[model samples]
Target: MESNQTNRALIKATVIALSVAVVTLVLFILPAEYDIDPTGVGKKLGLTVFNQDGESPSAKTSTDGDQDTVVVTVPAGKGIEYKLSMMESQQVTYEWQTSNGELYVDLHGEPDGDNTGYFKSYTVATVESMKGSFVVPFNGSHGWYWKNNTDKDIDVQLIFSGEYIVEGLK
Candidate 1:
C-alpha cells in the first residue's frame, strides 16, 4: 500500500511539472502571441486617426510632412512591456518591401522647445496583408501614413500588433 501511494504521488508531481512546462513554452516560444506590460500600455497607448481607412498611403498624406517630427504624444508609463520578434538575418535581408504598397512618412515640423520635431519623418512600406509586418522595438507601429496615389480615394484598413501609445496629426 505504501509503495502504491508513493507511485501516485510521483505521478501527480510529474503531471504538474509537465503542465507548467507546456504553459511556459507556449508563452515564451518564438512567434508567440503579442505580450506587453499592460500597466504601461494601458497608461499610454491610445488611438489617433492617421487617416481614414482605405486611402493611399504616402508621405504627402501627412499634414506636416515638410517638417520632420517624431509625433509620440503619449507618455509611456513606468512599466510597459511588448513582445517583439527576435531579430532574424532573413528579416534584415528583405528589400524593405516598398513595391506592393507603401506608406510614405515625412518629417514633422518643430514645436515649442521640445525636440518632437526630430521624431518626425515619414516611412513608406508595402501593405501586402492587413498585418503590415513590423520590426518595431515596441509591439507595433500602430499609426500609419497613407497616400491616395490612385485618382479616386480608397479605403485602407490598417492593423498594428501592439498598443498605439500616442497619436500625431498634422
Candidate 2:
C-alpha cells in the first residue's frame, strides 16, 4: 500500500539522519574538542592533537619549584609556536635569546573555551633577546610565536620558572 511505503521511507530517513550525527560526533567533535577517540578515526585524521576546549591532553598543573629550559630550532623563513597552560592568577618568569640573529616574536594568550578568536597579545616585535615575568589573567594557554626571517636556521634558548604546564616542543 502507498501508506505503508510512506511510513517505511520516514523511518529510513530518521535512521539515516541519526547515523550521520553519530558518525560526525565520533569522527570529529569528540577528538578535536575533548581528545576522545573511541573509534580511532580522529587519530588517523590527526585531529586528536588539538583541543578546542582549551584543555590539552599534554597540559598539567604543577606547584613544585618547576623550572625548564628548551632549545628550539626554526628553519629559515619558517615559524613555530609553543604554549604553557596556566590557571587564572598564576605567574611565570621567562627569558629567551636567539643564538644567531633577530627574529620576529609574538607573546600572547588564549582563554579556555574561547571560540570567538579572542586572544591577548603582550608583545610583538623583532628581538634577539627578552626577559620578563607574566601574570596569567584567565584560565588559558599562554606562549610565544617565533618566526625565523633570515636565510639560515636559528637556535633559540628559552628558559622559564613557573607553576604552569608546558608541552614538549617539536
Candidate 3:
C-alpha cells in the first residue's frame, strides 16, 4: 500500500512539471505571425546597433525588406533612434523603394563632421515598448560611411544583416 502511494506522488509531480514546460513553450518561444508579402527589393538589409557605452547595454534591430520594411524594435519601455555617426573619411547610404515604387535613398551625418561632430541626418525609429511590430516597404542597396577623425586608428564596425525573398532569384 505504501509503495502505491509513493508511485502516485511521483507521477503527479511529473505531470505538473510537463504542463508548466508546455505552457512556457507555447507562450514565449514562438514568434508573432506576419502577414507580410515578401516580394520586391531594396529592403533585405538587416542592420543592428548597440549602445556599447550604456550601463544596462541596450540595442535596436532593424530590417529593410522588399516592402520598404524598416522594422525597428527596442527593449520594453525604451526609446530607439538611428543616428549616423560618421567621420570625415566615411561615405554611407541606404537605398530603398517608396510605396509608389520610387527609389528611396538615405544618407547619414554631415559632409564635414569629423569624428567628434555628430552627423546631421537622423531617422527616428523610437520604439516605446517590447510589444511592438511594424513594417515599411523597402527595396535597394544601402551604402555606408567612415571617417577616421582620431589621431589613432579606430576599428569601427558597420553592422549589416538581412535576407530578401528573391522570386526564384537564382
Candidate 4:
C-alpha cells in the first residue's frame, strides 16, 4: 500500500513538472524566439518581432520621391530613434550633422511585420556627421538610433531625399 502511494505521488510530480515546462515554452520561448504566438500574449508583451526564417514580412508598395529636413534635440545622456518606412529597392540620399557633439549612431532596418525583435545593422559608429545614399534591401523601417553621451544637449539636423514615409522620432 505504501509503495503504491509513493508511485502515485512520483507520477503526479513528474506530470506537473512537464506541464509547467510546456506552458513556459509555448507562452514565452516560442514567441520570443520564433515569433510563434499561439496565445497572443507574447505579442502583447512586445516579444515577437521576427518570423521563423528571421526575416520581416513582404515589402510594401513604393511611394513617390520626396525630400524633407528635420531637426531634433537629443537630451544629455539620452538616445532617440528616427525611421523611414521604405519599400524594397527604394533609394535615399541622406545627410545628418550634430550641432555641437559627437553621437553614437546605429543605422539599421527592421522588417515590416516582424514580431520577433530582429534588426539588421548597416552602420555603427560615433560621429558628428554622416552623408550617404542607401538602397533599401527589404521592405521595412530603416533609420538611425543616435545616443548622446555627453553632458549637454545635442541638436541634429537631418536632410534626406527619398521614396519613403518619415516615421520621425520613436
Per-candidate TM-scores read: 0.26, 0.63, 0.26, 0.62
Local accuracy by lDDT, each model: 0.31, 0.81, 0.30, 0.83
lDDT of 1 by residue, 1-170 (tens): 99999999999999999999865554343112232223333223332122112123222221332322221211222111111122211111111122233333321122224444333222444343223233333222223444434333333332232222223232
Q: Candidate 3: minimum summed lDDT over ten consecutive residues — where?
A: 161-170
For model 4, the run of ten residues with the poorest summed lDDT:
52-61
Q: Give the TM-score of candidate 4.
A: 0.62
* lDDT agreement of model 4 with the native: 0.83
Tens digits of per-residue lDDT for model 3 on 1-80?
Answer: 99999999999999999999965444433211121213311122221123222222122223442222232222222323
Best by lDDT: 4
- How many steric clashes between backbone atoms does each model show? 31, 0, 24, 8
Candidate 1 is scored at a TM of 0.26
lDDT of candidate 2 at residue 93, scale 0 to 100: 88
Candidate 4 Cα misplacement greater than 4 A, ranges: 1-66
Q: Which is the winner by lDDT between candidate 1 and candidate 3?
A: 1
lDDT of 4 at 1: 100
- Model 2: per-residue Cα lDDT over 7-40, one tens digit each: 9999999999999999999899988667789998
Candidates, ranked, TM-score:
2, 4, 3, 1
Question: Model 4, range 1-170, lDDT digits (tens) per residue?
Answer: 99999999999999999999999999988887667889999888755632323444323222534557778788799887878889898887899999999999999999999999999998899999999988889999999999999999999999888677766665
Better of 2 and 4 by lDDT: 4
Roughly what TM-score does model 3 have, to 2 decimal places? 0.26
